[model samples]
Target: MQDRSTFHDAATPLPEVAGYRVLRRIADGGMSTVYLARQESLGRDVAIKVMRPEALGDEVSRRRFENEARTIGRLDHPHIVGIHQIGRTADDRPFFVMPHMTRGHLGQRDLAGDEARIREILRALLSALAYAHARGVIHRDVKAENVLFDDADRPLLADFGIALRRGYGSRVTSAGLALGSTAYMAPEQARGEEVDHRADLYAMGVLTWEMLTGRLPFEAQDALSMAVMHAQDPIPRLPPHLRHWQKFIDRSMAKYPLKRHHDAADMLQALERIPYGPQRSFSPRDAAAAGVARMRDLPRGAWIVLGLILAAGLGFGLRHGDDTARGFFRASQPQPAADSMAVGGAAVIDNPDDALLRAAPESEASTLVEDARRQLEQRRLVSPSDDNAYDSLVAVARIAPDHLELPQLSAQLARALATDAVRATKNGDDADARARFERIATLVQATGLADDDLARELRRDTTAALAVRIDAAARRFDREAARKAAALAGVANLDADALGRLRRQAEAIPAVGAVLPGDPARMTVVRSGDGAYALTRRHISRSEYARFAEATGRPATLCRERASVLRVIARRDWTDPGFEQNNADPVVCVSWDDAQAFAQWLGARNGHRYRLPTTVEASGSAAAVGSRAVAEWLLDCEGDCVRRKVRGSSWRRDEDSRARDGGRGYDDVGFRLVREP
Candidate 1:
């Protein structure tokens, strides 16, 4: 239906509405005013969301809003922002009451605080979504603004004004067809196609991308261009730090609804798998909810033992040092590996053109160039008094870490050195600029720098610059000498004959000699173990041509070991959507019993003896690296007394049994590899 509109000219003072006293306006949206209101009937404070008079007065839209109000009131969930009451005003405008959440949205908080906080927030959001989907409610609009916080700051999905049931929107027009922000809208939604809960997932994908990168995945000059990009353009790959989150976005923002997550609950569960920062059981409702379900199968003694173990682990982890305190502020600074800012005061680059130029198109080389420059600049400007200074230093440092004086100092130095060399060559004062270039190269290499292309360009530019200083008579000789020296300096300056010979020799060898599937390239040493099984070790091997003569041949082959290591044994938790794909890669969604049976079948297929599930310690450290990434389906044996069981995966937990399922099967994001040896 009709879009929401804000009341800019309404002069009436809203003293009371639907028996609730308005305190103040908490938020003003395009179509509604959210106020902190206190209910006179129950003497309780609640957030009263009121529609604009224009929207309420519209007959068709008002009926739809009333219907939505009833639908939202029936939904009961801990993760969902609860609805208290719905009523019409004296003037006949529909309004709804909800818990007065004072803390605000998760996006407004410091994300770098602790891993557990992030985890808790994600868990709560997902849990609420799961609850809503189970009841056939589609939020259709899940954005940061629609999410609010309880008194403790835990996330609660709010504002279902535009929500729809499975089939309610056909006569009313598609809910998201003409709605949602350009950057947050799903590709399907952007195209005005028939939408589903997957649209919410897509919005969440955009939100998560923003959360990790402090930037939107897609951008355009206008909404129309952005919509076009969403409809036709590919979703930008996440920055390095957010690579782990790709699977979530991939499933959430699949081109088609069928290709996206099965439902909100599935996406929420998958979110729990990602490692973020510190968490606490701050929400009493969440704590109560998770506890009741988990306690169903455990006996008194088992529960006691589990509690003791948890207490012991917590004590141990915190007794010596609190995890949050140890690295909270320190890790708040973005490390070399991460591309985003961890601190709030860091200067944000809003200019898109400069960013595009710095990054170029997506490629391994270009990514490295961008990353190296960014990292070097950040490293150089380790200390800055203000955000702008820090930001400026970073920009310059990326291009040249050595020259970190003024704004664009590196570019200035590089240009100055080049110009001086050119003048020296023109006037026959040949030494200075060449010496400077050489000094730059030495500094770069000594600092363990690795931008090979940049280094080569600098050398060539310096040589050309040198040419400008030499007299006419010696110019040709200087140019020739420069070219020859540049060629010999490990740059790609070989003749065609030599290149041809190298190519011919390389073509003779098979590209994959002793290569293993789903693994890296390296030399494999097959050795017989005492258990009468074959074990492989990675190693390097030289080609026969190189060994026989000093002639260039094929590239050396690497043999990676075929054997898999066991990660850990985890109990089956619940199903998660691996995203939608009309392909056979869809993982089998099974329960704990199903997983154990599958493990038995797998072992039987490999050999007669049953392969036992591993312990937490056994699956941890270097040992777990040999196991699987997806651990649920491959887990062996069930622990009868407790939820604790063995599976193939990494566990940040100590004695606590982690859960795994096949919901993430289609994901190459992370999984386990099995090997007998």
Candidate 2:
């Protein structure tokens, strides 16, 4: 895997090819030496993959190397690198030319942390796979190293040197020709059994899992051991956050070919069903194109009707604004002649509430409904699987429930979103799923409670999610988390037994009372020791520091580099501790001088003793075994006042974490002041 580009000068001779000039070597793969060269005839740069000198002697590998050109030439896809031409050297050494991808391979870049981008990447991947599969080409080697990209990070499949095509003669010199990268190969392929497109699908599943979680399902030190592992090992269960894809992965990577999706198209459909992430922006043109594709699948007259609807919608959209025009277009639909009861040759609007829509389709509220419909359609087509923003859709449904198809669509959306919420809950996205369910209830309400059953079910679903979380939190003895979950379940008005059961075993808390300073920081009595003097519950917060700064007119230096990207300048007061620390969190970046100043200010105002804790008081008196409560400042050393002993442990601990010496000085360090009252 050495991508060494050797320059040819006096000592090194420049390599030559048939129709191209080799500028330098780009990479060295297992069977080939890839070169960055300019195709003189085409006047463009290309990557020439030359069969390694050793590989040329092996007739089997040589034939297989030539087969790559034909395999890729037959399977032309945008996401797959295009073959320019095929040629052989004077010695009959095979080589092929392809566009030089500057961005290199997936192995050179990391994508495991980007879930949203990975899902989007998979969309393009499906398009490419479906195209290749239709042409009978199975990309046997689909590891990260074989996937190259352009400057924009759009992936292109490469190295079809070992591809297996159904109708074509494979480069299989023997019945036991070994193929593919070991770590990513399917079980059947690994075992050297007769493989099909399912092997390709298995590799795709393995690649997808690696992209998301950064590890192969089965791995071993040697090829033989790895092959055996793939054949016999049970599919590893995904983490809760990824369990939503369990069935999909299981089906795709099923050991038996018959058990997997029969074709690439079916696997693509399965991928399309997953609610990937946040809503992505899709142009109106894109929506229209998708709409046309969908309409093509419908009856002939449906396209004509669609054209008429778009015409009317555009006219209305322009005249009254996006909402009204959209509303006016749908509301203008001719009422079923027989369904509507006629009153003096005029149709009575169905449902009295929709009379406003029937009265004036040009009304702002009706327009809003129309716009809502357009938004809904775009959302459905653009992100068919994701449960995105529904505020606008719900708002318009309330105005024209009868005239527009809003009521019907709302009900369907309610059911779909509820199902998605349950799926999300199972995937451990409880907060997001709970929010989506709440939105579903709101949408149902906008439809004038048309489906009360759906509303009830949504409420039940939300309650159930909370119950699951509450039980889980309780099991982990996370009382704070359990309390929050139970509070959420209480919103649905759960009966005493169900909700009360979670709160029955109230967590024992120390009887520590708070003493509010004349300033801002609150002091709490140390329950583990005598209740004479209380240690500050937390270190001096930024708010307390701000107050100290404002009153004493002393400068509290604001931290320059803030961790919260979207935070305002006011919040960036110290070094970002890598994660979110709330207003309740102790303030960092304060020097010992700053800590003493605040303590002195509070003491002078309240006429009570306020000071840093003694070393024994911090180590013995404090209940410091929680996740990451801030480390506190201890009194200065016995003789040397310059160095102060810092006590307590944090989420990030060091070797000298408990060595209560005045040695560890830090910019983000915080301190606690104990009151001497």
Candidate 3:
């Protein structure tokens, strides 16, 4: 609808309203004219919303308008736009002052993967809804238009003119006196029944859906049909890209009030879990204060139209992250330790020995890499649902003996490499471990892993991370010229704090005590004599020792079993899939908690003794002793600091590494393994 025009000829600009000077019109909304005005005494800008003169002449319309102002005035919520002062013109026309907002609404022009912007918007809206619902105030008209963004880009819900408080339902206009838009109206409101906070949730669901998908769920030709769909229509499914957000969106749009999110607090928690992007700090109360100012000043029609444009723009522009623009849809447990292993993205090597033995010849590996390239080219022809092609390439990397043909591998290889590194560490192998760790740094620098800006930055930062690892290993072990070698390898000191910590840790280990066999750097192999020797050539385990101990104690046969958890660890001579068996990394799938539990179980099974997953730094330090046999593809704590990622691999994919990259990038990919702890 076109905005109402200002009546310039009606009267000369008024000097002040209750000590405020009238300025030019800033916005106009339905039933109100919002003007940008100034409080001379307070030296502040404020928005003054005035009742339409026509409505003022009608006792009923005037009373209804005044009631809205009074209802909003009584509310004090961070999310709900607040009221500062209320006054009347010489003719008794109601005017109210609220804080003035400078930032525009969420319009097509502002939506993008800007972490800060989206966070502000979500926080303000959610906070407002939460506060309003808690105090028995049900904002029947919750929509993008009704939400105002302030200078900080945080949201503030305005236009509570149509709010209905519980126990004051009688004050609400009777049936057929429709309020709120059909596009965002709740089912109860559409049915003309008693409405409550659920109505606001429905509106939020619609708003969030629009933010994600750039469209509404129902596209009816009339208001009645829309209402029908809202009340009884099946929950519409968003695009495949948005399926991951199903639970959040579905609950937000539940048919029953009780079925919807209990409140804004609950909904906001869900929003945080969805992993859109980095978040921006914002304050909703500040924005609401601004909206109040605008409402009190501009002409009603103009303000309404401006608000509509801002809302529409916001809905159109908002997206999850800077990666591929997947369609939007209507959108968390607890505090976990920073050091805990995340099993979402890592690979599991079930038989490290078998994997090493199965490594493919160089020629075969090359051909397999070729085939993977061909398959990637046909991704458009392949079902978007199928992610097998990517996995095949990863499998090739696992079986390759020399880890050659790195360029021909898929992005999945990055994950596989890390998985291999971790596995190698578990078995106490170190050479293969260092190679894989360095390989990851190189991959980030040269590969197409830079699909998104955030990922690219992360990859770049990872390069610096690798250098620090090399230096720490040398200092702790007292290895000669290690720091010089690191510099020669093109690794610079990127993080000062990390380097210092590594130095401190190295000093604590006290250069392997003399005559302690492997404690001495030069005689490390001395400890490998007799029963301690486990060959890299044979993927076999020495179950004899455990068996003998069990027999002496008369334990069960299974109790005597202590086979190598990772039967094999292999890297392809070239990138290829048939090489997966040859490659030998067992794609282990489990949560960080699950992995830790398994490690604990293993320790308990071994007579209450505990084993710990080696930190990435430790595994790298021992690379020389371990690299000859298995590569540690999945060690933790190497990078030192915890950094966040945009996309995570899925748990289902981890069960079978290939599936993890399915549909698109996933953030859950940081999956890791646990040692007997």
Candidate 4:
């Protein structure tokens, strides 16, 4: 058999498959090539997997390819990719069509440290596997590459080409080639022994480990070496922060198949029980061990210096009996008998410094405030436990509620957090940005700085950040992100009118894939008798018009320039416009015919219908349209249909609503588009 990598390249022209217009080849595997094509009857995108011509000579490859379509065709589940139809190309090569997953596959996503997203994907895959297992079909290859995501970002298990159904013969594959990925293969599967659904569960375990830690549990130089490692290597431990998931990992990737979860459903249950957040609690012994480990890693010179400091401090406490020394020694002591202290009905591990601060607020307040300032300087805002700025500031507030410097320090910290939020947003880490903003809000309340400058600065920064986030999300057509940003805006106390505008922008993203084509950042969602549609808040700009014109090779028509009366200037078109205007200015001098062409081009490109708004739709938006300095073309025509209706007042003359010849261009005439929902 030929190696899987030795198949046809996408550069080669694809053979026409009946009933589908093949756009391009998306993926190529050992046995087939997947094409992104439009299904003729349904007018929707679908993925068509066609077998390679070379694979036809091999009966085993042929049977496996046919088996994939038949097996998937028999199973019906939302999380599993279903076969729309099975057919053969002109040359008799078998092929199957599936939903076009535009979001790509699991392997392409940056899932590291995104626990919620990882869990969501895992749940979908497990549900799919459970459905398949009940029918006695095991997905032999359950790696990340086989999981695809649809446009809505829902994950679906695909490529059941190498699946093994119960009662199928024990031959895993042809001669020496392994049918599964070595990195995720169970010991039994790696050893060429009989396997069951537990084998699939083991691969799921490997997948879970990879998703959680961003790396595989075991690694080797080659496939055979990796297989050996999977069969014999001890299961690796998760990072200390993710230790809570170790039990799930151990059971899922057990060296022996029998030791793994009994079925996919059982494994999914185990997964659900695992907490999404960190749940590890440290005992005194664990803390001591950690301290010792840190000490061992320290240089000998540092250890001696630490011993001298402790010895000197002890002598000072004994000789002078100073309360500061006493407090220091008290903090150095081990944790109390009770591992955790109850606060506000929640069990939290006691912080020795916090306890000391509460016990002697008068003397410790200044020191705690200084420590907080230092932590803030280091950018250690809310992490590393007893050492972060947040805990230090909170301790100061509790111990000395009336401390003179408390308000200033709290405001500074809030400002720093807001800055971090903006930085995170710029870096495309929206989750971290939101967390920072939430922390700032909580900090203001927790430290009693709500009425101070902290609150004002927070509202200001949040308003600006919300504007950036909402506009960006709308441009990307990410409705969820926009909605979340709107919620954040509400939390920041944005005024009713401004908040409503932002909310409307967020709601319009999915309706049109983005804001209006020309405005770049502003669009209005309008509801009329025809239905809901998105309209550009402004007339199409010069820069936006240039793109359409350049792409379609559209020529500019003569415009009626206003200089010593109106005359059609041969050289004056939208590009020149007979006036000095920037790219941001509304494009003018385009005839009604040109506007229709631009609309058609945009609709075809975005997979959404676009056109000039009807007279009623334009009338409804009369306030916005009349404010602009250009008259816009409307879809309605007058009299013998020789003239198109125009709305809005222009810079030159006031023509609120009138009809003009469709073939001629005017210096003050341009257009806006309505995107159908």
Candidate 5:
């Protein structure tokens, strides 16, 4: 593909391309023109890249355009722009549709001074390339312009198939091969020799070089001269002040493909080694880690002395309260309790380095460490925002630095914190959620999860959660709530309607049928009798129970008094009887108390008051309609509320007789409503 392509004027009405209606020209490459088009069926905008009318006759360009579609169609990856549909225009031009990326390409994005974003873009590019390569497809052009971001700023590799151009010269260096962009091409690629995935790595190096220093790695007057420079020139060196990037750049762009990192995975390892931030963590070369490795060779007495020194340093350094600890200690020095974050009795040291931690890794310590980790896991799950759990885990680390479970535990805790953070944000506890995420950021090292992947998810979720809250606040016209929501979101996603959609879905109360209307002032009167108040027609159904459970954020469980581990009657829900249940059947298994709670909740939602039927009301209803199946609840018969008096025969009784019982529960047991007006 050429560095640039020309298309019809922006104001010119674009010709219809297949099923998509071209809205406007979005991009142009040497061989094709990309236009924003509306997918009528899907009701979304897509990018449709079609071969330029002039290039339709060129077989190479035709083949390349088709190949690009085939290449993208063959792979499915999060970082790669996906092909939506492929077709030919009325003018016989091949074109394919991809999800439109409005955030533009990385080359066009102003990512200056944003190291985190640059690293993220590189990671996305390399991962996409690696995936394509593993499947025998090479991304020959890996320049920043080929990388684009979605609405959430997630980078995607675009223009996959359109770059590999063949038959550039009869002076093939070795055999039939293709060349891509000249400035970013590898030596072999520039030489028009056979190339492989390694060429993509070279291109990425050039892209990275531009990202860090805002210039191409190798500058030349013309494409021909640049290709020559790439083939024979010394790999461009990053300036002395940019030395930290020298190793990554030089190795990736090495003249010899074999001299570069073997693959994307190796490159990722090198990238991970670079310090993305401050001394937030210890790396392999950190003095403490090296000293620990050396401690394995030290004598026992030396180890004891070192341990004491570490203890002393910890005591003097970690005087601040709470989970904020800046030191280490030994096991014999009395560590904090498993549940507590405050390190109280451990012997402190003046220098942590003196702890030449020499002692064969013992299973006893391992067992204790594992036990503490299990407790930590429990704490993380039940109360992830609890700083004490983090403090406790750190205490375990100080005592047993070499414990095998530390990494796994750290990762689990970080994941739990992230999950909790997202949950809190969704629940509108923005402050708590933000705090948890900040805490999670400090512990990403423990789990070995990719820092980028976790951070991206956290940020995305936080933004969405806040967006949800913003729409909700706007609906209520609460300016303070809106302001707080906006602050948490950092920047609002005005296009977001995720919250409004949920409001529509959640606000619908449970559907109840056959309501006997009463005065709107107090409550609905289902039935009026001499015994007490009013009664409802049918019994409460499973659907009502489910709605109550969901609205109250409470799980419905069978009454524990009658439920047993040995018996199969109760497994989960109050309505589910561990067998096939009729949705219309009166809800069963819930105790009188549970029933009362549901009544209270339903009444609150409906703006009324409800409670258990009085004994008089129950008997009067049975007498009024005659006995029927489905034994129902009545107010406590006697002084003891442990057993409720139930009136009417059950479904199995087959008798129209009015009878009352004070037993616990029956399979045919159910309840009906009696209301007040």
Candidate 6:
């Protein structure tokens, strides 16, 4: 096989497949070339995996290719890539279509140290494996390169070219070639031994290690050596920081299959037990160091008391001339009459511990304040360690208790967090934004900074941003965005009246493109030269017309096959126009009379007068809605009422407006309605 890296350097001719237009080659694997193509019938992008012509020459390769298509075609798991269609190209090369995973593969992503993301991918993959194993299928080629992601960044197990059914013999691998990638190959698999689902579990363990440490556990110069190492070498240990997963890795990569996890379900349970947060394991040396550090932090009062006891034990005589010793032990001893020492023209207090305590804390508080300010400048508000600004502030409060700078520092950190929260919100990361907001609230209450009004201002700004998101989503009919915005609003504690209005707007979004009588099509109010009226946002769709036809029992109209010629076809109507269309596509091939009939039927059912938009209304609405693929019928007619006016451009003609026969339907003509005020 040629190097996969050079596959794109050569300009390979695109293969012709029926009902699909191959746009470009996306990927080249050992046995197939995947192309991005548009499925014309569905009008959506799909990936077509065509067997390499050279592979088709080999009977075993041909069988494996066909087997992969048949294997995935029967499986219906969400995490598994599904086969859409299987067919042959113009040159008889076999091809199978699957969803175009636009986000690439797991190998292209960086999952290092992201336990939550890694766990998500692992759970999805394990569930897929479980499903496949129960159905007697084993994905022998489970690797990062085989795991693809969809548009939503969800991991999907793909590439089942070498998948084997439980009962099937190993004919596909009879050529003595190593099947899976050597880096992730199971020990048993590397030894050319008969393997089952447990082999995939071992491979999963290798993948887990790679994701956690950003490197493969075992490395060798060649595939042969790599395979040998998998069979004979001791299981590699995780790094010290990741030692919490040592038990999991040990069992999963056990030398024998029996010592490994019994099944995917059992592995899932083990994964659940693994903690996401870093675990701390202390050694005797570390404990001793901590003890020493604590002892060094003892106050001067404690040391003074120890010194006085020692002096009494030594039978030292007390004298007023011994000013140095007296000053040091003054707080612990009784007050000396008028002989108290005076320094720099100020009388020294008999109890020196009060001054010592205040001096020590003031020095410590100054250092803490400096550290906190530096951390704040570095944006280390709450993470990386106990050395962050938040922790420093807290330490100052504990030591000084009434440090003058504490409130100001707390307020600065709070403002910084508020900035982060707003940034997260703008980036559409509602969960991260919510977490930051909660942290800010905790800081305010902890420091008694509620009187600062920072929290209240942040709440108002965040709520306003979320409200904008809600309205924008409602306008675009994006239910997911609207739901996320609404959820964030709840977290922001938005006022009830405002929240209720936004909720109602989101609830009004249409579930489907079909506009029933009770649920009218989306419209925009247009103020034209004649009057103000509401015009439909888009041209009438086939699904909407289908509803109207079903309810009114209307017959299909004869539609012209082409716009230039009068070649009227009896079978061609809105349902069977020359091209394919989904429900959302504008309904073409409807005559002016047919459109009028539909408007009348809808108006009567909804108790509102509806008619085709006049030329003036459509011209005004076009600036707002933009031109569509089809020309739309208008209420105005030509001389003697023989032709009706059409506005906007059509698929065949890019002209703005034209007059067409009112009784005949053109394939590129549709209509939109105007609702009377």
Please give, for residues 1-677, the per-residue lDDT of candidate 1 as tens digits: 11222343346667357567777666765556777777775577877777778775666566566656766665655567655556666666667777777776655655642545555666567667766777777776776666777776667787776676765764363444556677788777777766676777788877776666666788899998988887787778876655666777777767777877777655654664453322232598888888998888688899899999999988887866664455543324322434444368774444333343353456443343444356345542222333322334344345545542332333433344445544554454445545545544443343334543344444444333322222121212223333333332222233344334333333322221222232221212122221111111210011211221122111222111122242122222112222332222212222334333333333322222222234432243222222223332234334453343434332222332444332222121122223332
Please give each candidate's TM-score.
Answer: 0.39, 0.42, 0.40, 0.43, 0.41, 0.45
Q: Going through the candidates in order, what is the number of backbone clashes in each? A: 51, 5, 109, 0, 13, 0
Q: Determine which window of 10 residues in candidate 5 has minimal summed lDDT.
A: 523-532
Q: Name the candidate, 2 or 3, with the larger lDDT value.
A: 2
Number of the candidate with higher TM-score, 2 or 3:
2
Cα lDDT, model 5, residue 94: 80
lDDT (tens digit, per residue) of candidate 2 on 1-677: 22434443447444567767888777777677788898775577888888888887787777777777777766555688777657775556778778888887776666766876776667667667777878877788887787788767788888887787776654363247667877888888877777777788888888888887778888788988888877788888877677756777898878888988887766765664554332245799999999988867998787789889999988886877965556656665555657569899887767553455655436755665555566555655114334332654555655555656566656666677777776666456757666665766566566664764555555545545555565454333345655666555554444566567545532321134534434345666554432234677666775666666665666654432224454453434343534566555566656666778778767544435578888766654554323455566667554456666666655445423332334323434677887653
> Residue 184: error of model 3 in Å?
0.6
User: Candidate 4 versus the native: TM-score?
Assistant: 0.43
lDDT of candidate 2? Answer: 0.65
- How do the residues 518-610 of candidate 3 rate in per-residue lDDT, one tens digit apiece? 221122211111111111121111132223233223222111011334323422111221123222332121223322333333332222222
**RMSD in Å for model 4:** 18.5
Error of 2 at 212 (Å): 0.5
Residue-wise C-alpha lDDT for candidate 5, range 523-575, written one tens digit per residue: 22232221124456556777767777765556554433344784564354455
lDDT of 4 by residue, 1-677 (tens): 11122234657987687778988777778888888889774589987888989999988888888878878876777688877668889888899888877777777667888888887788789888998999989888999888888887888888888888766664634334466888889888888777788989999999999898888998889999999999888999998788878989999999987789988877876775565466656699999999989989999999899999999988887887776657666545566759786889976756645565445444788899989889989988988887998888888889898999888888878788877876775455767877887787777667888543345445545555676678666545566778888876665565676588778888777553234544432566655553445777778888888987875668987777435343532467888766788887888889999998887666544444578988777765643333347888999999987899998778778766878888768888888887654
TM-score order, best first, reads 6, 4, 2, 5, 3, 1
lDDT of 3: 0.51
lDDT of 1 at 439: 43
Question: lDDT of each prediction vs. the true structure?
Answer: 0.49, 0.65, 0.51, 0.77, 0.64, 0.77
lDDT of 6: 0.77
TM-score of 3: 0.40
